[model samples]
Target: MVESSHHEKDEALAPAEMLALVRDQQRSVEGQIAAFVPLLLVAWGVAWLFGLGALWLIDGMRPGLTVPPAVAITIAAALFVGAIVLSAVLGARSGRGVRRDAATAFPAIVYGCTWSLGTVAIVAVGLGLLANGMDAALARIFFPTVLVLFAGLMFVLGAAIWRAVPMLLLGVWIVAVAVAAPFFGYPAVLLVLAVGGGLGFLALGALSFRHLSRLRRPLAGGRRG
Candidate 1:
C-alpha cells in the first residue's frame, strides 16, 4: 500500500515538474535572443553594402558613362527589395516560438514599414514637384530627405527599441552627412552614404558577430567534448 501511494505522489508531481522544465527552457531561449539579437546587424550590413554600393557606382559614372535613370532606379529597387525580404526571413528564423518570435520581429517589421512608406512618400513628393515644372536641381533634395528618414528610423528603432549604441551613433553621423551633403556635391554625398555608412555597418556587424561567437563557443565546445 505504501509503494502504491508513493507511485501516486510521483505521478502527481510529474506534470508540475514538466511545466517547470518547459518554463525554464523558454526563459533560456529568451535570454539567448536578448543576447544575440544584434547578430542581425551582420545581415543588415551586407545588404546595405550591396544595395548602396551598387547604386553609388551607377550614379558616380561620368556623363558619357551615366546609367539611364530607369535602369539605375530599377536596380536600386531590386536590391532594396531583396534586402527587405532577406531581413524578414532572417528575423523569422531567429525567432523561436510563435508569440515570442512575433514579439521579436514586430519592431523590425514596423521599422521596415516606416522606411518603405517614408521613401514612397518622399518619391511621390519629388514626382509632384517635377510634374509642376521644378528644375532638376530639386532632385538633390531626395538624398537629404532619405538620410533624414534613415536617421529617424535608426533613432526610433535602434536607440528606443533595441537600445543599440552603434545604431544611435550612426543616426547622428547620417544627420551630419545629410546636413553637409548639399554643399559638398553629389559625389561626396553618395560617398558618405555608401562608403561611410557601409563601413560603419560592417564594423558593427563584425563586433556583433564576434560577441555572438563568444557567447556560443562554450556551449558548442561542451557539446563537442
Candidate 2:
C-alpha cells in the first residue's frame, strides 16, 4: 500500500503532469480575462449595423425613403455612445482581481487611453478642417473614412499587443474598407461602412464565441476527468 501510494504521488508530480496543470491554469486565466470580449464585439456590431445603416438609408439612398439625416445621426451617436459605455464597464469588470506586472499592464493602460485620446484628436481635426472651409459634402466623406481608419489602426495595435491573428485580420479588413470608402463617396460611403464594418464586427463576435466554446469544452473535460 505504501509503494502504491508513492507511485501515485510521483505520477501526479511528474514534469508532464505539472506542465499540463500549468497550461490549464493559464487557459482558465485567459478565459476569464476574455469572457467579455464577445459581448463588446457584439455591442459594437449592433451599433455599426443599425447606426450606419440608418445613416445610409437617410443620406445614401432616396431621402424620401428614410428618416431625416438629423434623426439618423442622432441614432448613430446614441448607439456608439452606448457601445463605448459598455466596453468601459466590461473592461473594468474583467480586470477586477487580476494582477499583472508593469510590463503587461502598461501596454493595456496606454492602449485603452489611446482609444479615447485618439478619438478626440480625430474629431478635433475633422471639425477644424470643416471650420477652415472644407466643403460640407467632403466633410461627410472625411469624417467616417478617417474614423474608420483610426479604428482599424487601433485594432491592429491591439492585435499586436495580444498576439491575436483574428484581430489583426479584422484590422486589415477595416483599413481596407476605410481606404476604399473615399472612392465610394458620401452617402455611398455610409453604405460601405454599414455593410462592411458593421457586418465584420458581427462575424468576428460570432467567431470569438465559437473559439471560446471550443476552449471551454476541453477545460470542462479535464475538470471532469
The per-model lDDT (C-alpha) reads 0.64, 0.89
Local accuracy of candidate 1 as per-residue lDDT tens digits, 126-206: 789778997765576465446554654556466778787766776776566566556656645565565555566668777
**TM-score per candidate, chains pooled:** 0.67, 0.91
Model 2 C-alpha lDDT per residue in residues 1-225, reported as the tens digit of each score: 999999998987898888989889877877887888888889999998898888887866664777787999899999999999999898888888788899998999999899889989999999999889999899989988899999999999999999999899889999998999889887899889878998889899999999888888878888999
lDDT measured at residue 48 in model 1 versus the true structure, 0 to 100: 57
The superposed Cα distance between candidate 1 and the true structure at residue 210, in angstroms, equals 1.0
* Candidate with the greatest TM-score versus the true structure: 2
Consecutive 10-residue window with the lowest summed lDDT within model 1: 34-43
lDDT of 2 at 158: 96
Candidate 2: which stretches are off by over 4 Å? 1-16
